[model samples]
Target: MSFLAKIFRRRPRPKLDLSHPQVVALSARLRALHAMPISSKEEVAAWEVEAEKLRERLYEDYKEVYDSLPHEIEHYLVDVDIRAKDPGYAKYQAEQLVELLSLPEEMPNQSPEPMPLKRHGSS
Candidate 1:
């Protein structure tokens, strides 16, 4: 192979393995924690810390999916417990990391905030 060809070629990315026993167990625990109803500020604080630890562990074991995991986690954590709705939301987010990894060359869709609309007559 020519030197330039070798230099310019993109190396294959490392595969993300979601089936590891430790990962599976952690995920299950995360899901259960998320499923628990939020009752007090103290519990929420505890879950937040727990989630941070899980995020760090996933970062270490699956660097390939690290960039995507935080988004899923944040999406759940922001919800207000309104009207008996979506429980176990964190598990859904945790699943999203795995789902993104399964897709071919799919990066997390980090949508930017929409620009504020200006009045046509105003600046």
Candidate 2:
């Protein structure tokens, strides 16, 4: 959530996804880092922090997919099968993000009034 979201309004928090590979890989990497030496405390700390961030981002992506996954999303991707989890999930997520980004331009209040149309020889 952003400062603006806090002050104005906030969208619902997304659900956690345990199955995404990025989530699984980052968790494994974090565990490995923990098992290694802590001598270079700063470097280790930095990597640990980065892994946490990746985890959060993957969770957010999954949440967005869960929120608005359309049936058409399955058929939409070329050379990809919806039965395959990641491919299906990504199509819906990408579509959702595109819709959100395009909304501002669609708001009636944000658009200028249309020019009046004239009929030929009309008073």
What's the C-alpha lDDT at position 29 in model 2? 44
Mind giving the per-residue lDDT tens digits that candidate 2 earns over 30-49? 33432333234454455446
Candidate 2, residue 24: the lDDT equals 42
**TM, every model:** 0.39, 0.27
Clashing pairs in 2: none
Candidate 1, residues 7-122, lDDT tens digits: the string is 99975644444454544454565555554544566655666676566656665665545443435544544442420234344334435544332322333444222223222122
TM-score of candidate 1 to 2 decimals: 0.39
The C-alpha stretches of model 1 lying farther than 4 A from their native spots are: 1-18, 64-71, 77-123
Q: Clash number for every model?
A: 0, 0
Candidate 2: list runs displaced more than 4 Å: 1-8, 39-123
Q: What is the lDDT of residue 79 in candidate 1?
A: 48
